[model samples]
Target: MYDIKALYEATSVDDACRLLKEHPGSQVIAGGSDVLVQIREGKRAGKELVSIYMLDELRGICLDAEDNIRIGSLTSFSHITKNPIIQKYINVLGEAVDQIGGPQIRNIGTIGGNTCNGVTSADSASTLFAWDAQVEIAGEGYRRVVPINEFYIKAGTVALEEGEIQTAIIIPKKAYEGYKGHYIKYAMREAMDIATTGCSVNVKLSADKKTFEDVRIAYGVAGPIPMRVPTAENFIRGKEVNDENMEAFAEKVLEDINPRDSWRASKAFRCHIGVVMAKRACEKAVKQAGGDVDDRTEL
Candidate 1:
């Protein structure tokens, strides 16, 4: 095991920021679920632990009077999974959180840490991407906001600059008000496997369900990053959820996702699963949008 020069449990945002500046080499830890194991496995190394859990500024789940849900950075996945606001407004996010690791891991892992870690299998990442979520970041001079889709530079790396802390994750109320979505992960096993491929679909459909208004799709574990499926999304928008459109949408997604080597699954299987997951997720999203699509119909 590696050793750390110090461990700081910051009680406030100012205190946390001060400690972070004092030890530039320090790594911020909230849940310590993924990071601690990564450190012990020699995947992540650091000399200090700056605990952000005690920072009251980084803890809580609340709804403002405006109906927008404001989630603190340190909010746990379990907390998010159970939050009624999340359930009612961001069901896809809640669904993704429920499938992460397990109840015990969920209880400790923070939603902010999951996406900030920037791994492709991060359960909540693509869900946020589908919803057009925004991450709030703060640093020395001021704060900045970036859409969730652009938050990661690469695997295991966040776009957050040095000394900056992600203050909150603001999921806009508009994304949730009249829309609905579904998240589907294709994994070998339901319990422990990372997604071979995962998809989240969000849509606003006509009352008759014959046509769609707005549509969004995001695919994970398909490329250098978890990403939005723009080609697939474009094909589904304004199109009827018929067999022809489903096939066209699947073909569209095939153009974008090419899976890579992973210990748990083969590339071909991953590719196949991505296509299957995308189709199913899209259908479910359309249904949730109050669209009248018979899922039993062939694609």
Candidate 2:
């Protein structure tokens, strides 16, 4: 067995940062759901563990001064799913959170841990990336923020360096207003399956019910990272979305997606599902943004 030391608890972000500096071999542990599993599987063996879940500064969610919603790094998936603000507005993100594990895991697994742990299959990440979310990094000397897309360097890899902790996630105000989106997770079963296929769509509604505006679509477990679907997005942007635009967008999904492994689903299955999901999301969002009645909740 590997030798290890547990620091018991951390009271605040400042306290946690200090401990991280003092214990060079230590790894910050919160939500223990992911880290504990890794430790048991021998995927990681750190000399010390600093439990930070108790740190008040690292938990909670709220809109910041700029009206951008900032989700505390330690905020649980349950919190994300239950927050009326998130549900009433950023429904795409709320939908993603709802799919994360069962009730037990949802109560404990956190967004910070999900992003930092860097799992390819993390469901929340796809929506976060789609929104061009930003991350607040806390450290001893200073704090800095980076866009979510830039935060992850690679699969299971991130830009988090020495003495830094992901303190919060910030979603810009505009991304939250006049926005509509849908998230679909193609798993073996809705209850306990990792996404074989997952997709999120975000669209900016034009004041007039005619033209489509900014569209952002993304997928998970499809490639090395969560990414915007460029080809499909471009196909429908600025156009008067209709059955024709949806069909064209669907065609683009086939060309745009870059599938990696085969487990989530066969390449063909994911590609087909990606195209179909994108079309459905685009139609629903366009309808809503234009102030029309479209009762389709495709997710």
Poorest lDDT segment (10 consecutive residues) of candidate 1: 290-299
Candidate 1 stretches with Cα past 4 Å from truth are 296-299
User: Model 2: how far is 153 from its true place, Å?
Assistant: 0.9
Question: Which digits, one per residue and each the tens of the lDDT, describe model 1 over residues 1-299?
Answer: 75456789877776777778988878888888877887888765556888887766676777868766788998998888788888878878888888888778989989888888888888788888888888989875587888887788887788887677888888778877778899887777888668767788888887777887778888788876888888888877888767678767866887888778878777887777777777777778877777766665221
* Each prediction's whole-model lDDT (CA): 0.80, 0.78
Q: How many residue pairs clash in each candidate?
A: 0, 1
Best by TM-score: 1
Q: Write the per-residue lDDT of candidate 2 for residues 11-40, one digit (tens) a residue.
A: 777777888888886898888887777777
What are the models' TM-scores? 0.93, 0.91
Candidate 1, residue 95: lDDT: 86
